[model samples]
Target: MEALRAEHLDKRYGADETEVWALRDIGLVLRAGEIVALLGPSGAGKSTLIKVLGLVTRADHGDLWMNGERVLDDGAPVADVGELRRSHLGFVFQKANLIPFLSARQNVEIACEIGERFAPRARADELLDYLGVGHRGDALPNTLSGGEQQRVAIARALANAPSLILADEPTAALDKERGRAVMELFRRVAHEQGTAVRVVTHDHR
Candidate 1:
């Protein structure tokens, strides 16, 4: 089954004379349990695409289906976007962005808890353990290594038990080895949890 899919997506800034198009007629279908990377050169709409997929930015024209439900049509919100992003989607960014004062476990739990209260603690622990960061659960974000912090970010993204996970330049902050480790962790999550993973990256390697 397709966890997330888009058709004829477009995003634009301004109108008429000064119009600038960030994305034009983009479409993608991602099946659950699939790990796919979004690759393109700079200014190729990667950010625009991710923003559209993540429900942070609206498309000028398009349709979106998340886990087979239509949430967008012609770039407009079909349903409540706040609910859509909160319940059905997970995201990881370039930096781990874990709260510095929060423990690894707390950081994970808070993200999941903010929208949905159920299973927050359990989900946090499960993801941390799965990502091999359970041992560092109580450590503050600043206390963990860069790779470990990134792992915690991955775990946090999984804390919601989402059907789809979207990552933008997630590995850009890590070294070569750590970057691979982050990507592999995403793959494992997609396979084991039956979640669809879309990673937006500029790393050609």
Candidate 2:
């Protein structure tokens, strides 16, 4: 089934004179249990496209459907964007962006509390364990290494059991080995959990 679909997406910045067309007539379709990577050059609109699809930014012209529901139509907003994001989408940024004062477990636990129905802490631990960061659950974000921190972030993203996962430059900061590991983690999560994953990155791997 289609997890996400965007058609004829167009985005521009600035007025006519200094205008920049970040994306033009772009289209994307993702299916459940799929892993896809978006690659482009610095000015290739990769980030802009991800933001548009992730609903962080609106597209100038397009239609978007998620899980067979029309969410965006010709720049119009969908039903409660925040609510839809919380219930159906998961996002990971270049940084882990975990709350500094919270432990890895707590970081994920808070996300679980937002849109989940089960015991938050239990679900958080389960996710952390599943992501191979179970032992670091009690450690603060600062205490963990880059890869470990990203693992915690992934666990947090998975806490809500979102149908689609959007990651922007998720492995940019890590070394080649750690970056590959993180990419592999995304692949595993998509196939094993039946979630569609889209990653925007410059890395060819």
Candidate 3:
């Protein structure tokens, strides 16, 4: 089944003269249990596309169907983006951005607690264990390594069991080995959790 489907998506900024086309008639379909990476140079609208698809930002034109529902249509909003983002989508950025005071498990559990997801801390520890970070459940973000921090971030993204996971430059901060590990973890989560993963990166490296 397709987890996300975007059709003829177009987005622009500013008025006619100063307008900039961020995305132009872009179309994409992501199947369940698939891990796809988006590669492009700076100013290529990669981040813009992720934001629109993730429902963090609205698309100026086109439609986005998540799990077969029309959330966005013809540059207009049809559903509550905030609610949709919370219930059906997950996101990760360049940094882990964990709460300084919160431990690993707490950081992961916080998302599930706020969202409608059933599991909270239990799910967090489970995911952290699966991601190979269970040993650091009580460790603060400052105490964890870079890889561990990203792993915690990934676990947090999966806390809600979202059908679609969108990440922006997720592995940018890690070295080659750690970066590949993070990418592979995304694949594992997509396949194991039956979620669709879409990542935006400047380089496949």
Candidate 4:
């Protein structure tokens, strides 16, 4: 099933002499159970594409569809963006960005609460276990290793069973081995859970 589709996406910053086109005529399709890596150097608009597809930023012009439903047209939202995001979208970032005061499990549980899932605590525990971080669920973010932190982040992203996940440089802070492990985790999550994933990275490996 098609998880997301974007056509003729154009994004520009500023105007006139200082105008910069962040994205121009970009098109993309992501299917359920598929993982796509977007590679580019800094300033290549890779993050811009992610922001657009994730619905965090509006394109100057384009159409967007999620799960075969039209969500945006010509840079305008046709649906309730917040509802769509809460129901179908998930995001991970370079920093684990877990709440400093919350345990790994609480971090995930909070996301479940936001999505209005039943039994947030159980769902959080289940996702942590699935992500191989069950043992660390009670640990605070600062006490966890970088890799473990990312694992918790991933679990939080999956709390609501989103159809699509957007990750931006999720492993940039980790060593090669840890980075590869996180990437592999994403692939596993995509295949096993039938979630579409798009990862932005500078690494070509």
Best by TM-score: 4
TM values, all candidates = 0.94, 0.97, 0.96, 0.98
lDDT of 4 at 127: 90
> Can you list the residue pairs that collide in candidate 3?
none
Worst 10 residues of 3 by lDDT: 116-125
lDDT of each: 0.87, 0.91, 0.91, 0.93
Candidate 4 per-residue lDDT over residues 1-205, each given as its tens digit: 9999999999999999999999999999999999999999999998899898888998999999999999989989999999988989999999999999999999999999999965898999899999899999899999999999999999988989999999999989999998999999999999999999999999877
User: Candidates 1 and 4: which is better by TM-score?
Assistant: 4
Provide the lowest-lDDT 10-residue window in model 2: 75-84
| Model 3 C-alpha lDDT per residue in residues 1-205, reported as the tens digit of each score | 8899999998898988999999999999999999999999999999999998988777878988888888887868888878888888889999999999999999989998989566787888898999999999999999999999999999899888899999999999999999999998998998888999999999667
Off by over 4 Å in 4: none
- Where is the poorest 10-residue window by lDDT in model 1? 112-121
Which ranges of candidate 1 are over 4 A from the true structure? Answer: 15-18
Best by lDDT: 4
Which 10-residue window in model 4 sums to the lowest lDDT? Answer: 117-126
